[model samples]
Target: MKTFEATARSKSKVDTYISNFMKLHPFAAFLTVFVGGPLFTLLAVAAAVYLIALPLGFIMGWF
Candidate 1:
């Protein structure tokens, strides 16, 4: 029981530490998504371009 209580307290401390860290460094999370968002958008645009061009390319090549 004592060990369990100790472990729970440590867990809560870790949670509090992380919460404070994030609060102090909110841009850490924002930067992750900000950088990821552009890469994801680029991939989506590439996929869309490939999809759109595939048919056009096929028609142009046939002619």
Candidate 2:
């Protein structure tokens, strides 16, 4: 119960912070969510795949 309350309190704080940020920087938030998110996700996924596969490829003699 204590943990649940703590989690909820922190979550609401974060939600409030984001709400205020979005209100202040609506265009920045829009660009970040719409344009930057997909690009950042793609980059992160590519990096993860590269990091995981590079060693595997060498061990499997596929490289």
Query: lDDT for each of the candidates?
Result: 0.87, 0.98
TM-score of each: 0.48, 0.84
Best by TM-score: 2
Give the top-scoring candidate (lDDT).
2
Worst 10-residue lDDT window, candidate 2 = 28-37
TM-score of 2: 0.84
Model 2, range 1-63, lDDT digits (tens) per residue?
999999999999999999999999999999989999999999999999999999999999998
lDDT of 1 by residue, 1-63 (tens): 999999999999999997888788889857756886888899999999999899998989953
Count residue pairs with overlapping backbones in model 1. Answer: 0
